[model samples]
Target: MKEVYINRISKYLPNHPISNDEMEGKLGIINGRASKGRRIVLRNNQIKTRYYAIDDHGNITHNNAQLTKEAIVGLCDDDFKAEDIELLSCGTSSPDQILPSHAAMVHGFLKNGNIEINSPSGACCSGMNALKYGYLAVKAGQTKNAVCTGSERTSSWMMADTFEEELQYLQTLEDNPILAFNKDFLRWMLSDGAGAFLLESEPKGHLPLKIEWMEGYSYAHEVEACMYAGGDKLEDGFLKPWSEYPSDQWSKKSLFAMKQDVKLLGENILVKGVDSLKMALDKNNLKPEDIDYYLPHISSYYFKESLYKEMIAQGVEIPWENWFMNLSKVGNVGAGSIYIMLEELVHSGKLKKGDKILLSVPESARFAYAYALLTVC
Candidate 1:
C-alpha cells in the first residue's frame, strides 16, 4: 500500500481564560483545597481557555455549524482557495443540524464546488476517526487532499440551574427548593474549542508526515452507558440507564450492533491497548521501540495514567511529566484532542522528521480504537 501523510495541522482556542480560582468564586465554595482538588483530580482537567461561538450580541452560540465554519476557515486562511479543496470531514459529538451534518456547514463556508463532504459522529473519538478516514481516502486515491476538523461549543448546552437541580435531586432524592438554590458542578471543566488539519497525498518531492498503519475496534456492551438528545431535559444526566420505553430500544439495538473485542472495565490496560498496538505494528513489521511519541486520548487524568502504565509495561518508556498534556489547557475537546495534540507538537518543534507517533482512543462504550505509527516527515 502507498504511504499516507498528514501535511499540515492547526488549532484555535478562544481568547478568554477561566482559571480554577475564578470557578471556585463562581461556585461560592469556601474550600480552596476542594476547588483545586476537583479541578485537578476529580475532573481530570485544568483547562484555562476554550473557544466559543459568539454572536454579534456577544452571547455564546453553541451551534455546531457556526463553530465548524469558524474553525475550518481559520485553518484554511488565505493559502488555499475553497474551490481547490476536494473533501471535508468533521468529527464531532455535537452536530449543528441532524439532517445536514456539521460537515455540510463547513462545505458551505468553504464554498467548494463538487466536493464530497461528511460529518462523522464518532462520539469522543470522532476527530481521530475523521483523520483516519481521510488518510485512507487519500491512500486509496479517492481524493488528492482532505481536511479534518473537530469543534465544540458546549457552553451553549450548559444550563447552570439545570445541573444544580439535577445534583440537588441526586442529593435529596427529589427536587427541592433548597436544591434549586445550590449550583451545579463548576463550569471549569466544560469549555468550547476547535481544531483542524490539512492532509494531502504525499507527492514525489514534497516531504510529509507518513501514516504507517491504522486500525479500529468497537465494543457494544453497556452501549446505554452514554447518550444525549436535544433539550433541557433532566433525565439525560450521566450514567443514566437507557429508557424503558419501547421506542427507546433503539439505544439497546445500537449497543447490540457494536459488540467490541475487549471486555468491560477490563483489569488489563496494557494487555488490551498495547496488544492492539502490537497487532498493527506486527502487520507493518514494526516494533514498539520504533515509535518516538505516543499520543493517547486524554479522556481523563486517571485514564491517561492507566494508559501510561500499560505502555510502560510493554517496554515503552515515557515520562509522565514530559508527556504532552493538553487537557489542562483545553479540557476534553472530545474527538479533537488527539489531532490538537499532534498540531501542537508540530508547531512547538517537538515532532521531528521520521519520528513515529502512536495514538490510542477508547470510546465511552467499552471498545478501544488504536492507531499505530505515523512517521513525521
Candidate 2:
C-alpha cells in the first residue's frame, strides 16, 4: 500500500480571545447564582482564554464557511493552487446551514473549479473521520493529494437569544447550576477556530507526518442522546416533530437549541475513550511505548487524572508527561481541536526527524471515538 503523508498543516484563529474574567460579563453570570458555577467550571476546565469569531461588542463576525475558507487558504501558497486540489473534506459539529454541507459551502468560497467533496458531519470525532477519509483515498491511489479541514464557530450556537430564559430555568433547579446549565457552561468552554491539513502520497518537505494507522469507533447504544443538537428525542427513542421546537431553533440559522446530558458525558467518555484507544493500539500492533508524543483531544483538564488512572489500571503505561493538551489556550474546539494541536506541536520544535505520534479524539455525542498513528519524518 502506498504511504500517505501530511505535507503541511495550517490553522486560523479568530482575534477575540475571551479570558475567564471577560467571560463572566459576556455570559451575564455576574452576581447571579450561576456565578459560582461559572467559576467552578473555569477552575475545573483550566482554560485561560479561548478565541471567538465575534467582535468586541459580542456579535458574530464570521460564519462557519468563512472560517473554514481562512484555514484552507492558509494552507495554500504560490506553489499550491486551490483548483488543483483533488479532494476536499470538511468536518464540523456546527454549520451555517443544514441543507448545504459545510464542505459544499467552503467549496463555494474557494471557487476552486469542480472537485470531489466530502463533509463528515457529527460530533468532534468527525474531524478525524475527515482526515482518515482523505488518507485512505491517497493511500489507495484514488487521489494524489487532498485537503482536510475542520472548522467550528461554536460561539454562535452558544450566544442564544433565549439565554435569560435558560438562566431562569437553571436558577430553579436543585442540581448544581454548573451541571444544570450545561449549555451555558459549555459557552465558556468552546470557542471558534479552523484547521486544515494538506496530505499527499509523497512527502513535500521536511517534517512531514507519515500516516501509520487509523481507526474509528462509535458506541451509540452506550451513549444515546448524551450530547445532541436539533430535534429532540421522544421517550420511545423516536425523534420529536421538528415543528415542536421554536422555528428559530432550526439548524438553518444560528440557534442554541442543543440538549446535553452533561452527567452522561462525565460518566462515559473517560472509560470508553481509553478502551477505544487500547483497541486502536492493539489492532495497529503498537504498544504504549511505541508512541513518543500523545495528542489527546479531551474536552477539559477535569478528565486528565481519570484518563491517566484508567490507562495505568488497564496496563498501558504511557507516561503523563508524554501527553500534550491545548484546551487551556484553545478551549474545547470540538472537531478542530486535534488539527490545531497537531499544527501547534509541529511549530513548537518538540519532535525530531523521526518520532511516533498517537492522536486520540473522543466525542460525547453518541460517544464516537477515533485514533491515529503517525510517524514524523
lDDT (Cα, tens digit) per residue for candidate 2, span 1-377: 68999998999898767898877555455224444457777888899999888888866778988998999898888899888899999999988988788899999999999899999989798889899999999999999899998878877666544355544455576454342355556766787899999999998876999998899988986556677776666676555556677775454322345556678788898888888888888887899988899999988898899889999988776897788878898888888999999999999999887799999999887888999889998
Candidate 2 residue spans exceeding 4 A from truth: 27-36, 164-179, 233-256
lDDT of each structure?
0.58, 0.82
TM-score of each: 0.75, 0.91
Tens digits of per-residue lDDT for model 1 on 1-377? 55677766667665455565554333334211233334443344435554444443555554666556666665564566666678788888666555777787767766668888877775666777787778778888999888888776555444333234334435455442232111122234445667787777763323357777777765444233322332211334333223433544433222111122122334533456665665666677766566677677654565666776776777655556446656776666766677677777777767666677777665553345657467777
Poorly placed runs, candidate 1 (over 4 Å): 23-58, 77-79, 161-188, 203-207, 221-272, 314-322
The TM-score leader among the candidates is: 2
Q: How many backbone clashes does every candidate have?
A: 5, 0
What TM-score does candidate 2 get on C-alpha atoms? 0.91
Pairs that clash in candidate 2? none
lDDT assessment of candidate 1: 0.58
RMSD score of candidate 1 (Å): 6.5
